[model samples]
Target: MNTMVWKVDKYVDNLENNPQVVDAANFLRKNEVVALPTETVYGLGGNAESDEAVAKIYVAKGRPGDNPLIIHIAEREQLKQFAAEVPALAETLMDAFWPGPLTIIFKRKEGVLSEKATAGLATVAVRMPDHPVALALLKSCGLPIAAPSANSSGKPSPTKAEHVLDDLNGKIAGVLDGGVTGVGVESTVVDCTEMIPVILRPGGVTKEQLEAVVGEVREDAALTDEAAQPKAPGMKYRHYAPNAPLFMVSGTAGFLQRLVEEKRSEGLRVGLLTTEENVSGYDADLVLACGRRGELETVAAALYDTLRRFNQENVDIIFSEIFPNTGVGHAIMNRLQKAAGNKLISE
Candidate 1:
């Protein structure tokens, strides 16, 4: 299959009718997949209403069929077609963060979205991306596009077009290169089918932000319970991992530095993933400073690529300092913990 790669602008230039955009949208209409940029991350997209189309996405990414995919829409009015009933909280959140990076799971309208897209469940995950290219693609395609992270399953999500090509160059139809995505992660998933909203996954949207609108929001227990069934995309697998083993340590900078040195003395090539403030404190063979302390958004942006870099350098093991559990920090730690496969050590 010839994978078409096209460069798109941040804003549309008659995008709905652009030949290149049309070609990409045409590919999607024919029950094929396209990797398109969103504010959060690149998604390998297929028409949500078609089983064959959604099936192609899972095959391309080697994603588990049981793990649900998020459907992307062009506007809020599209919700009525897919959802059985949109709750009051869903309306409030849509008003607050649609065309951004928030995903809300709602009860499905019978025979609406394909069963394959919903993972045989009664609910479906959906979001409207903020990127012009993404909105243009969805609008041109004229259908809800069910997409999962474009990377091969259980690996890091793509925040750039190059990252999509790195993992899935020929596996799908094409990629719409809208340059580097802004949020650098996936959407925050809120399950609104219940009486009270429960967060299945944390991403670009923070819990505090959700609470501000909904009054009170709870997190899914499946995030930490290994024996439990996964309710969202990232919870079921060892995701966002690189080739090298990653370990998370919760201790003072001194303790982290000593641990790296101890590993180095054992003839192991160690990689330290730390903050900018403590970059000089680490004595590892390789150090990747994610970002400054207290700026969790910056840290989120660099975390995945840093893991990929350690792989390129062929480090034996990587050590990372954990982040705070509030705001965007929660999402950062969630990805790192999955990348490390929950291999955490305390003070």
Candidate 2:
């Protein structure tokens, strides 16, 4: 399959009618998988109602069949077409964070969305992406789009059009390039089936932000307990990982440097993943800064891109500095921990 790249201006006022976006939407309507940009990351989207379209998404990303895909909708009213019922809490959250990076899991209305998209589960994960290009594509296609991060399974999620092409070029139908993503991570997934909502995954929307709107929100045990099964998309598998083995260091910079030197002494091409403030503090084969630690949002935004850079440099191994698990720091730490495969080294 020849994968086409359609570059659309994200700033266009009438993006829904843009030729490039319309062309991508046309592909999607024909059950052809296309990658579209969102505020969080580029998504490998397909017709949520078509089995064939959903199957192509799994093949393109080599994603596990058991791991469900999130459904992206353009309008709020579209939720009723598939969701059996939206709880009161979910409605409040929608009012607070719809068209943003927050996915809510709700009980499904059978025979609406493809069973494959929901991994044969009774509930479905849905989100209204904030990006103009994403909304335009969703509206143009007029289908509940089942989408996951447009990257190969267990690899870093694509935050830019180029990143999508890096992993999925020639593999999918085409890419609706809308430049770089803002949030730079996936959406925060919350299961609202029960009275007390539980956070399945942390991403662009922080737990603190969610709780502020909905009051008492609980986090899934799987977020910390590795043995527990995760209820959200992209959480069941190792994700945002680089080609090289990444070990997260939860100690002082000096201790991290010592570990880097120890690896270098063994004739290894070591890489250090740190912030701009600590860039000069490390002397390794390659020391890349993933934004400033003081501002955790920057760190979260640059995390995936930095990991992809290490792959390009062909580093033998990586040692990443850990961040605080508060506010947006929670999300940054989550992705880093997953990327490192829970490989943590203490002082």
Candidate 3:
């Protein structure tokens, strides 16, 4: 497939009427997948109502069919079209975090969306992105779009359009580049099917923030227990991984440096994924700093891009510094742990 690139200004007004967006929407209406920007990450989107379109999304990303995709919408009224029930807490959360980086899973109305998009589950994950270009595309498409991270499955999610082209060029229809996304990671996925909302995946919207909006938010057991079946998009898979084996280090900077030296002694091209404060402290083939430790938000934004950098450098092994699991740090550590495949070394 010839993947066309359509560059549009991120801040342009009346994007729904923009010719570039209209072209992208036309592709989506024809059941072709297109990569569009969201506040969180670039998403490979297709018509959620068409099985053919949804299947193309899975094929483009090589994503497992069983893994559900989140449905993106432009208006809140669209929620009533597909969702059978939206719990009170979900409505409250939508008011607080919709148009941002929070995905809410609700009991789905049968025969509304493609079963393939929801992985045949009884619930559907949905979110309204805050990005104007994304909203314009959604409005133009005028369909519930089932979308997943626009990258090869099990790899780092794309924060920039260039990253999407790097992973998915020639595989999908086209890319509507609206510049870099704000939230580096995917959206926070919350299951509102149950009485008390449960968090299935941590992302831009922290658990603390969710708890602040809707009290007593519970985390899905699948987050920690591999045996449990994950009901959300990002929960079941080992994602955001680099080409090299990454190990999470839990200890002082000196201890991490010692391990890096040992790997270098073995003639391995070692790479260190650390913070700006510790970048100068490490001596390795590649020492990339992913934002500062003091601000976890910056780390979340840079997490995937840094992992992608390791792949570009072709490092033999990677040693990553662990972060405090608080606020956005929870999301930062989650992606890091997934990229490292839970390989943690303590000091």
lDDT of 1 by residue, 171-208 (tens): 89999998987788788999999988998999999999
| Candidate 3 minimal-lDDT segment of 10 residues | 228-237
lDDT for 204 in candidate 2 is 86
Clashing pairs in 3: none
Q: Rank the candidate models, highest TM-score first.
A: 2, 3, 1
Model 2 RMSD in angstroms: 0.9
Score residue 175 of candidate 2 by CA lDDT: 95
> Each candidate: what lDDT?
0.88, 0.92, 0.92
Candidate 3 Cα outliers beyond 4 Å, as residue runs: none
Candidate 1 deviant stretches above 4 angstroms: none
The whole-model C-alpha lDDT of candidate 1 against the native structure comes to: 0.88
Better of 1 and 3 by TM-score: 3
Cα lDDT of model 2 by residue, 14-96, tens digit: 99999999999999999999999999989999999999999999999999899999999999899999999988899999999
lDDT of 3 by residue, 250-340 (tens): 9998899999999999999999999898799889999999999988888888888999999899999999999998898888888888888
